[model samples]
Target: MSAHTWGSLDDASARALMEEALAAATGEGVTFADVRLVEAEEERLYTDLRGELDERREHNAGLGVRVLRNGIWGFASAPVDGAGSAAAVARRAVAVAGASTGTAPVRLAPREPTSGTWSVPVDVDPFEVPAGERHDLLQRIVTAASAPGLVRSVTAGLNAKRQHKHYADSEGSRQSQHLVESGAMLLAVAADERGAQRRSFPNSFHGNTAAAGWEYVLGLGLEDEATRVGEEAVALLGAPQAPGGTADVVIGPAQLALQIHESVGHALELDRILGDETNYAGRSWVQPEDIGTLRYGSPAMTIAADPTMPGTRGSFAFDDEGTPASRHLLVEDGILRDVLSSRDAVARHGGGAGSGSDWPGAARADGWAWLPVCFATNVYLEPGEGSLDELLDRMGDGYYADDNRTWSIDDRRMAFQFGTEAAWEVKNGKRGRLLRGFSYGGLTPQFWGSLEAVAGPEEFKAYGMPCGKGEPKQWGFLGHGASPSLFRGLSTGVAR
Candidate 1:
């Protein structure tokens, strides 16, 4: 057998190899099987106050086979050479499945077979950019962030990835896709006797990522924003501690996106509600019986799980299991309407009463090596009728918080607390003095129910990050969209 570079293979060759693997599994008496071939390239650069810290480039190519035998699932993966190697991996997966036991017979919800190709629109591929150019970009961001005398240090970085995948299943679905992603972040830190404060641009955890190329990074205006971040970090060093009391609070889009991620996004996964993810992420407060009747939030709250949104980190034509992507409502008019589910989950627990007949397409794996699971895609709260100024005027007196600093949530995802990097008192419909160490806590449902206003589409924005879940902990990139929103009468205080 001759060795072949999977990345260099054309789409036709890749599909043929996967089809051969599925055929081999069926020949071995496997009830169902699928094969995924993946080729990926990644580039990352990091710089700090001292200048360039590190640079990394990586290339990976592999094939994974999933087989179902006797109602049990088995998965195996290895570097691909040709059709012979693919067949061998498939047989290994089938043999493993034959030896396992399952509590209940496995079944998959019906899905129409699909075949197509999709690619993210890109202006310039990051990999094609010179390494020196990438280094210069990071250095400029760091320089701007460190210009402040009170700034103790600065960190800036850029990350990019390109992936090519071909999937084939026994059900006659064959698909190919090419995806490109780019992200950048800058953090400024200041310290004093009171405590250290930090401010970040775009977002906090790993910054913002999107399905685009070098153009996406250029559009962030990191150099222009770095000085403001540094100044804010220094300003927070002398700001008074946030007054502790019950008061209306306004959350900016950046922090609100994370709030949606921890409280609402994780709680709605069907696997968690059904107890499949209890050990890692904990069971959800949402029970199967609560799907139709549960009051999730105020009528102003509407959340949708959509993968069709352009340029989002979670945008993809089809999931790993060959399910076509579509927009599905998870919450409508504050009513619980749907849950993020895999095909198997839908088969086991039928789409709840009042939920639409369409299957929610959200099954995804971190890569070809991991098994696909029910993961949140681009879940976002729809923008409401008002603007930030209007919402602030309505608040009368409250606090405006933005950019998450710390967050804690219980296993059930019901009770939670979050601290923000910066906040300001709203007095007589205008922002007053800045306050430091501002935090808030409340029950999930009640907290959302307090939502009384949201900024209009002009203020809406989305952020992306790698979300960690599952037993072995697969980190998948996802997106969350939000606008500045106002909540009434929540417990507010300084972090304890």
Candidate 2:
């Protein structure tokens, strides 16, 4: 396929617009201001069992301006055009800020002026791949999962995105970043007199995404996994329901990824704890005072909010606010230590000024049109010294579950229930038979405290998903790195 460019403005042209917009905002006497020009493109293709196909491609380019006046903030965005559009957006943002209401001026943590360019290193840009090749790949995967009459339907798809951003701020920070995200998914469904059963490859929600190219999707081995996924769905139609009562269980990487996201990552965001998200996304069970005091989990648990891990969806050289990316521990040896914080939200930790260390470069925006907010980056559970086999051997007899099927948590992010797409009964330290409708529930702190062992780095995997937050609602792609974990005596049952 012939390569094509997607942006309307070149690097130099977009940078000039950002500079012009920043100058106009500062000229209006705003204490803080920033301008961003973002150009993004996405391609998605889907193939179904009946040889049906759906393809979508989209491209968007826009300029966004954010300004702080009299302690309140305002934002405005417009289609990327010329100097006129930039200046107009900047002026509108300033006016909105001037008319905003706030009891106190926004105080941002100190940050030195920075300038740099960062891009996702990719061997093959997905956009450069031939359209026919992409469609054929998905079709092949779907066909493999057809499974004749046993499998009623099958669907497979691939998605890729490329984004270019030019950013500038009144603080003398100027930077450019290029991002490429690739991912794919496969689903197989089977039906019997009981009900319909479904199975997914890699993950359930849009499969797994990463800050890489088509190489990431190729590495997923969907074509190879498709057959097994179909067989599993058919098997589930007759498998016994998950057992009830308490039992030790091994939580696989995919399920643990979401577990970490809902119970740990979101619960530890500084904004959520400070109640900034209560009106929309709900608040956390953790409190500002809980840091450095609460025992978040067992000593085997260590979690960090790391945005510096290369090739992960959340990894970035700098956040949308120009804060240099850094890795910091959120839970150290099971103790609550820090949080996912931003320069603005960090100051609101308590009535007193919060430390800058609380900020882990977590400020980000969904797109150019959205305002930056405190969001989780790559929150991960640090791997331990045992393999999955070792953990299962250690557990003796119990269950193994992976890939989320259903999950529900309270507004406070405390109590929760999660069901897996597939599970296995463990007998004599060996995986035995598959169990359907497997589910477990527990209180957040109590659940983590039951951790018995964690698989080593060899089993650790990073999974990415789009998380939603904010009043108008915005989606931030986040990564969660996890490994198989052994927990003692979890409450287990069938969903129904």
Candidate 3:
């Protein structure tokens, strides 16, 4: 197929191809089978003090088939061409399945067959925009973030992806989806006798992303935020080192999102709890017996695995497994309630056996070349009743930290240390001197148990980042949402 024609097939054509592949696999004596076809396009642009540093555009299309035979699973994938190629790929997957061995037959929890077409709503398609225009926008952001004397360097960039997927299974389910994601970031660096300090706009680590289009990028207000970022980087050059001691800490949404992602989100993956992901990501500190009884946090903490939130990076109409996306609570009223689960995990963990809990529809593949895994979608903390100001007033004296600088978490995700870009002393409900090198440490449960307050819904924000897992190391973008929150006495100090 021509590069220009990749992912060009209409919904009807893609559905027919998927049905043909599923039929071929079942005819080969496979007990179960599914087919996924994906076509994706991505564009990225980076600009710095010198000018455009890097620009990339990529497009690819492929098909993958998964089959089960004799209690073993097999998967095969290759570039797709004409309609005749689907059957060949399906047969190859069945052959691989037949040659494998398993200790027991594979089982998947039953699900109602579903058929649908879905898409992310976008006011303007990034791909349809001119490359020159994108470059110009990034250049403007970089230029605005540059300071000749104080800030030594500045960098900015934009990244976007458009993916089209069609999925079909032998059980008569058919799903097609189109998703678009866009994000941008700006970074500024300044140096002094102490060391170099950097500041980023919107959020850190390549900024924030959403399942929207160019309108989302435009709404970032990079140009408006640029000067403030530059000024903060310069200000940090002479700031006093953070004091070392146990103290109350208020975390801003930008840093809080990451804290939730590392501590709560990863711990809830059922595969990790069951020890199936120990090699790459390590096992979870949570156990199956702890569900619905463990005091994971304080009453102020509630996290939900929701894939139906519009414009979230992880939002989807149907997961790669053809399961309808839905919202479900993971933690409620300080108790561990549920874990992210796939159909396979549900079957193995007794979720569908009248336990009043079914699969949460968390299955996802990085692309057509990979198989689905139980991964986090839009896992987020539910907003509380107060605002950031109210939290500071409630604390009276403490520290305020924002934007992550560095972090370290144990393999089990039980203990962690996090450093933030900037901090301030909150004395008598008033902000005080700026402090540098703010860092904090605690066990996951203890840290969450300290939750005293969370900002209201208006203050909550969601950020997107690539989450890595699996042996071959597939990375998928996911959203983590949070609001500014206050935690009670915790171990905090200045990083040496």
**What value of lDDT does candidate 3 attain over all alpha carbons?**
0.85
Q: Rank the candidates by lDDT, best first.
A: 2, 1, 3
What would the per-residue lDDT of candidate 2 be over residues 1-496, giving only the tens digit for each residue? 1122556777788888888788779645478998888898988888898888898999988988999887789889988866588988999999888778988778877778889988888888898899888988988898888864789989898889888877899889999888888999998999978899899988887788899988888998888899899988999999989888899999999999999999998999888898888888789999888877799999989998888898888888888888878888889899998888788887666443235543587888977999888878999999998789999999999999998999999889999999998899998899999999999999999999999789999999998888988879898898998989999999998355
Listed in order, each prediction's TM-score against the native is 0.96, 0.97, 0.96
- Residues 197-262, model 1: lDDT tens digits: 999988987788889988999999999999899988999999999988899999999999989999
| Model 3 Cα shift for residue 71 (angstroms) | 2.1
Mark the regions of model 1 whose C-alpha exceeds 4 Å error after superposition.
1-6, 27-29, 351-357
Residue 207 lDDT (model 2): 85
Candidate 2 yields a Cα-based lDDT of 0.87
Q: In model 3, how large is the Cα lDDT of residue 452?
A: 83
